[model samples]
Target: MSESKKILVPLLIALIIVSAFVSGCVDESSTSQSIQPQEEAVTEAETVTETTTEDVTEKETITVTDSLGRVVEVPKNPESVICSGAGGTRYLTYLQAQDKIVALDSTEDKVSVGKAYAIANSYFEGYPTFGQSGSENLEVIVSLDPQPEVIFTMYTTNGYDPDELQDKTGIPVIALKEGDMVQNREDMYQILRIMGEVMGKEDRAEEVISFMDATIADLNERTEDVSDAQKITCYAGGVGSAGSYDLMSTDSYYPPLYFINAKNVAYDPAAPKVAKVSKESILIWAPEVIFIELRPSQFEGENYAPYQLENDVSLNQLSAVQNEKVYGMLPYKFYSHNPDTALVDSYYTGTILYPDEFEDIVLEDKAAEIYGFLVCEGDVEKGMSVYETMLTISSTPVFTSLEFD
Candidate 1:
């Protein structure tokens, strides 16, 4: 073969190998470009899945029916809560679920003296104040660091709609019907039951109900046989509007009166639940026994009902004052009816009215038992101390006897 022919054949083979190598490189580059978009798409899909899962986790909720018959979606396990109206905090404290309370109404925080709950749960004093009772501050509530999951309030208040409140605060608002505790006890029970369900303290709620039931039954059994002639005509003074004090104010259906079967001079079918009667009417009624409901304001002032009764010229003529049948009782209706304190008042009223029926009872011991069961943390002695403190601060006679001449 010629030299030129040999060189041309080798060059052609080299050129063919180069062409194949370049084609392989081009194919690899195209493949890398195609795989990159697919990898990015997979990463984006994963990110979306994570975000959706987080949203679902954050939005978990459950349905509840409030006392006003409004259905609402609330947190499954509410970690933070606020009691927004009068006596609203009382319910939470009664349930022993005040640990979950993140904020309080201004009235609850502002009042230095009142109900055993406030005295017992000192921690509540430090909680942030959302607003005054019946008038919550929407901006302050929304600005809470760990936002409250729910808001509890009374159904009877005007201009406070649960739906509107929930919408404004982005929190569930539950309105409970807190009727007259003496006249409508079942309503109170229902309120407790609903609170128990919402607060995850159903068992504790049942325990309280049982205590109240047993106490009422025991009280009734002792006094059931007493004749109408034996029943003492009584009047509860200083039964002012919630959270205030007025000497002439009285309850038409005081629990102590109902429990002990006493005749309430203020009880009139036509009268409002709480009524203000004149001194002339009081003279006409001439109650045999008078119970002065000690108020917090009276603690610092000289206008306490007992002192007023003692000094009043017209009141001195009444049999209760003249015969010294006047007694002092812890304010049963401060903020609202304190069922526990009212129960304690019942025992005192019963013992005074029918000494023979309650001869075995001791007032301080009995008060301790009720307070321990209802308020104290299983410490009967502490309960007694709290009760004594209440009496002392209010300037009330702890255990005055009606048999005194």
Candidate 2:
């Protein structure tokens, strides 16, 4: 073969090999590009499915039985809530779950001025009001921007039903019976537990109950050995519902008197729990010691019961008034019974009734300790001024005589 022929054959073979390699590379690249888009589409679809499933799970509802024995469906985690009736907001505040409160009753604004729970949580003053007790503004509640998920209220005497309220508002209404904290302590504890569950503060609720248990135990330990005859005969005055004070307003089942084992002259099992007695009865009881409920308006000189007791001629002849056994105590029934304040009042009562037994307890220091636990976030000094302003040595003169002007 000639040189030219040899070169042309080799060139032709070389060209064929190059063209085949290029075609194989193009086919592989096309296959890889087609597979990539399919893989990406599968991955995106999986992500969307997972997100939808998670949202559905979060919206799931759980069934719970309220204080009234009604089984209702409530959100797994309630984000917003409305408190109605007496002591409704107080229970929430005790749990430190005030952040969940979407709206408050009008009474909260007035009571929050000097009250321990109210004074500690002044932010609640700005939230919208949902009307007063026995009258809740359903329209305003529904119009709330985020809308509340649950409603907590006390059982009323006028036949207000939780089931009916729930139906009307399309929100879960849990009715709790505000039983006497001293007589029906378990009921109060159950109420706290239920509220804690609703507000996601179960641990905090347990803490409150434990504190109450510890307080009662401590009081009993100090007074257990004292004889019944040694117990001071006492009468509590100026006690009423929703901050209303009557000269004869009193409760037979008052917890402070009960817990401290003091002999309550007004206690009669047959009589109503709370009633306004005749002035003649006050003379008849003639208690050795008289505890007058201090009012916020005493400074304003309007409807001050302590001053009324001081000036009343009929009460002057009594041993309590004659011997200066009359003392001022924090109003136990402002809006509703304040368990924390009531506990503190018991210590004060115990200290006065039996000075020797409670000698180690400084009333102010004890009050500060309780305030720290319940209202001051464990800071003993932080809400002490509010407590201090409630009573003073001149006001609550147990051993000393008050030289009134």
Candidate 3:
């Protein structure tokens, strides 16, 4: 019962209460601190997920097949492209997609592609030409100006890498398989379809393909079931070369030859490389019909020369020689494997193979009709002159009586 003692007891009790409140606040703060680490971990995991998504997006890729049988994967749509295949560069001209082409090969350099060549040469006069020396040089290809975004090589010929080329130069490699020179229009259309997809000119590509399809359909209707008896066996080649020197086989775009039921003197193997025949082999095969691919140099213009005919033998011994079934095709204009010329050659082969079936289908008149499709007006008079020149040496003089005009 002293007043001072009572006051001390109450003060001690108040201090204990304050201590308990402070301890409770500290425990609650510790719980909040425990939750903070979990929130930080969640945030870090979200950031990692976003980064992974970005990486995947950056690594997105696409693959395309080339003229050869190889498949190539590239970054999205390529801007600049280099074509290294037989008639590969012609696609640009066919589609009017020259702006996409950054470089071209030698055949294109020689202006071998007719109007397409002229147009591209005029447009890309300053661009480097790579395929001129019969082969490709990797160094020169790597040194191209404004380095190409994609390098497209032929499946059979162009020697380049898909992944390696990309790793070295950061450019994708595309394989554009070159169809057989004598391929049918359906095959050519498939090729065009692939080309259109690569060049981003699908509409134009389809248009050309449809036109070719119509042309081939018409040719088929005209020459279906040509007589086996009428089907002539043709032998062709350069004058001096003894190796394979015939026109294209089943692998080439000259399907019209097959359509007309004609047989080439050269036996087509399971896998054929060239469409030629040799002299020694020619002697053995001795075709029923002879077709010499007469060039401007070999056969002088309008005059089928007085050249030696195998040991100066009389023309009566050979079947074709006796019957004067020998003829000459225009080696210059009709020799190419381009879309335009291929169709012309197809029609030409059909007519030659089954003249009876195609009796109404005059060569010069058909040539003129095909001229519109070929994007060039072939000279009918020039064709007759070539035919006459081929028949000049014949003892029988078969071409002399035929009315070419």
Q: What are the runs in model 1 whose C-alpha is more than 4 Å off? A: 1-56, 242-244, 297-304, 401-405
Better of 1 and 2 by TM-score: 2
Backbone clashes for every candidate come to: 0, 0, 25
Residue 209, model 3: Cα distance from true site in angstroms: 3.1
How would you encode candidate 1's per-residue C-alpha lDDT over 106-200 as one tens digit per residue?
A: 87765545478887787887888888655778999999978888888877556667788888988889888887666678888877887888888
The sequence of per-residue lDDT tens digits that candidate 3 reaches over residues 32-56 is 9999999999999999999998778
What lDDT does the true structure give each of the candidates?
0.79, 0.78, 0.53
Q: Sort by lDDT, best first: what order? A: 1, 2, 3
Candidate 2 RMSD to the real structure: 3.9
How far off is residue 378 in model 3, in Å? Answer: 16
Q: What residue runs in model 2 are displaced by over 4 Å at the alpha carbon?
A: 1-46, 49-54, 298-303, 383-386, 389-405
Give the winner by lDDT. 1
Model 1 whole-model lDDT (C-alpha atoms): 0.79
Supply the TM-score for candidate 1: 0.81
